[model samples]
Target chain A: MKKLINYTPSTATRLFLGLLPFALLLLVYMGASEARLAENPNDRLLPSLTQMGDAIERLAMEPSKRTGELTFWQDTQSSLIRLLSGVAIAALFGLVLGLLTGALPVLNAWLAPLLTVISLIPPLAVLPILFIAIGLGEASKITLITIGIAPFIARDIQRSTQQIPTEQLVKAQTLGASTLQILMRVLLPQIMPRLIDAVRLSLGAGWLFLIAAEAISSTDGLGYRIFLVRRYMSMDIILPYVMWITLLAFLFDYLLGLLNRRLHPWSEGTNA
Target chain B: MSEPLIQATNVGKTYGQDVILERVNVDVHEGEFITLVGASGCGKSTFLKMILGTEQSSTGSLLLNGKPMPNEPGPDRGIVFQQYSVFPHMTVLDNVVAARGFQKASLTGLLFGRQKRQARDDAAAILEQVGLGHALKRYPHELSGGMKQRLAIAQAVICKPKILLLDEPFGALDPGIRADMHALILDLWKTHKLTIFMVTHDLKEGFYLGTRLWVFDKLRHDPQAPNAYGASITYDLPVSQEGRDTLDEITRQLGASRPTIPYKETA
Candidate 1:
């Protein structure tokens, strides 16, 4: 046998190894669920796979008792609307602010300290203030998500903007570019791919803030559904909802990665 | 004599207490290739930056055609650094085309439709002349050091600046590639009648490429405060005809300094 360090896995073996842990987790959950149910048929801690499937069908296919709407799709839609709106606004404002502060020394000096202080403040602590100021409607939740991630994105963009080579800027100026031209032409395009990457990194935090706000106060959302069902210990519904959320987050991440690679081929290929 | 295109009087620069260059005065006429040589940290690059207008001389004045050099970098002055001077996001063709667009257009830094097609044709012709026609679609990262420098040269010259500044443009290339670059630069300089200022670590390169050569070194040295005195143009030799003795003197002086030796003494 080859030494472990020297041995490299083939493509097929690598795929199998990647899937092993996930399969093991599934088996463990199924076995524990069976044992619990065999001991007490009424145990709600671990729902059998079939029970979770049934809960998913009911939530996905049937109308809710009170609202007459499919709770599953409704919750997903509401949560997605909030998440997208907040992230979109953050991206727009972040790009503008980051571009200005990074390219202009005066703006950088004035705003860098302020941005640093704002990023340092825990966004969740400000959630209560946001609810009081903006109210506990869709606006408050969206603002929470926006406030939670915009600074991070802006700060990231500022750094990437600053990181653009001085040579490139000088070259542009020598070509007779105005200050605004250099910003839009030389600096802006270079940092754009980086901005997409920064947004990708901040998505996880965005999801967290979204769920926190929804769980605290919301009539409809993925987090609201999960928290509402928890009163009856319906692990069947909660587990499937959790699985759904994970799938959505995974899909989002995959799509963003694809967009980055597609739109910014140079950034992905090699260092400049 | 006709007026010199560029004139300097008592040019000096300092950052805080660190004096980098001082009391530098020279006159460069049109179409003269002036190469600068100095030890590392001797402010050769600093002097080039001053000429490029990215940096200003702190103490003295520099003139172009009997007027002050523009405070902001403009189309009259084009420059190429050793590396990282090309736009990686753009393909070779776009890099050259963008230079023109940046100078002409007010926003988006782009030309569209008929103007865009015209720009592309002009860029293509220049790239072809630089032997980069085949790689017009390639990004900067995809090209080798030599090719990137070619692209840089193409970009610098596309705007037809009155002066071209190269700061060790070929320093990172291998010898075989450097020779090709030297030929290309000379050809371009002759064809375009460009007034060029280049800084090189290699003394032989300065001698071979430039009509006139300059050496930057400090006359005084203080042990405790190394930067108390700034470097000045120690030797201004016309390398086209009488540089042998000046080369020997430079090599001997560089040998004695024991550090920052940019050239070797030849027996």
Candidate 2:
């Protein structure tokens, strides 16, 4: 095998690069806030480092008061459950629809217009109708995510399935492989790299939609906590929660990126 | 004598308004190495396709082992294409073992590990035969052009088909590698006694490896027309035994003052 040049950054290097900016910003903010607090201890806009540390301790100690504490953890858990289940359901639907549309031209033509129309309507626009039909509860949020994500996944899978070379299919047929056999042995293996890429894209989109969904209507969630803190102009509490959310998102994204790299080593050079 | 392994009677093919081949007749005997030499667009590949059952002959019949060919590809005939046709994602072993997926190898036999041992053994043996024993775990992208061609040949022959069809298998290789592959093919043929039908445009290759050479002369009739007929026959020269002697005599005559007769036809 030919030796490939190693120019791409390793995972540890990427993580360090991603976190450096936030660390620097936090240090500058800490120094500036300390000076402001020392000048005017009673200023509503400024909070001392000790006061911010006290707020963190208080939020951790009293889980009942300060809607931020209860709402953040509750929303985080609910959003995760809905995202997981919604992804499962959407993948099931996408796999079937993608397979059928890829195998039959007539079905693809018939479903093209309907899928386009459905995909065109923004999930936010359909939120009210979803709320009216299913009430303002977990169902609404889960359904919103499912509708938002299924089309993109289906489209990605269908295009990937279609892009497999005809020569490979012909070779499989010459080997006496049946339709199912060909799909399982030849088509699936060839399209797996593309499918994993699509799934990673969908995961990012799913998180974005979850935040938007939680921000719209919810008694609890990380988004709701951030919004509630903003109303009182409490940057101390809001900044920490924002830090937590950013850290979580980064963790998920980094983990998925690692999985993608591990599964497809050939894709590393193209992933910049 | 028994019947030829493959017989084509008035086999014809037409694509819409264009006639590719018409009334083509050929009989391939067992263990006979035949080379079909033709210029491009002479329908040599189409004829091979008809034999492989990948394309339908619009007019007549084709028989393999004195039996009618089905509408799809079968294991009775194995084909090696000119381009790299191995599966890119599969290892060399998987690519070779895939040909047996439809035969006695059952789904349960494959899943429960009954066929794995046999497949590995067979793949190793065939890879050794084709000088690719060390490349069993390598993918297609890791192989060179010559190695890829050798892998294709090994994959085709691993199925043990009755007739092996090669469509310009060596046209893409360099001259040195092509010569080496030709010698390897001849050695394998001597041991396996396979009925080989190859399509090549190289005249020297045809003279070296073909038991019977078919020359497709396009300039026979109308020189201006693109479509022309051709002829072929078994080379029945006594030079098969005394080819070196004949070359020496020709050199001696050329060196002499007297010009030798160049028009004498020998058989």
Give the top-scoring candidate (lDDT).
1
lDDT of 1 by residue, B1-267 (tens): 899999999999999999999999999999999999988888999988888887888998999999988776778888988988898899999999999898775876788899899999999999999999999998888899999999999999999998999999998888888889999999999999999999998888899999999988887888799999999999898899975787888878966765545653222
TM-score of predicted structure 2, chain A: 0.78
TM-score of each: 0.96, 0.74
| lDDT tens digits, residue span A64-89, model 2 | 66553544466567667877777767
Residue A242 local lDDT, model 1? 92
Model 2 ranges with Cα > 4 A deviation: A1-62, A66-71, A103-124, A133-135, A227-230, A233-246, A264-272, B9-14, B17-19, B36-42, B59-68, B102-111, B200-203, B213-267
Taking all chains together, the TM-score of candidate 1 against the true structure is: 0.96
- Put down candidate 2 lDDT per residue, B1-267, tens digits, no spaces: 778887888777777755566666777789888777554555677777777777888887888877887776766677777764676767778787775554543431132276767877887888888889998888777778788888888877777777788888888788888878998899877887888878876655655786765543222334454344332221222223435554444334323412333212211
Model 2 pairs whose backbones collide: A75-A221
State the DockQ, from 0 to 1, for candidate 1: 0.68
The 10 consecutive residues of candidate 2 chain B with the worst lDDT sum are B258-267
Compared with the true structure, the alpha-carbon lDDT of candidate 1 equals: 0.90
DockQ of 2: 0.21
Could you give candidate 1's fraction of true interface contacts? Answer: 0.72
The candidate that wins on DockQ is 1
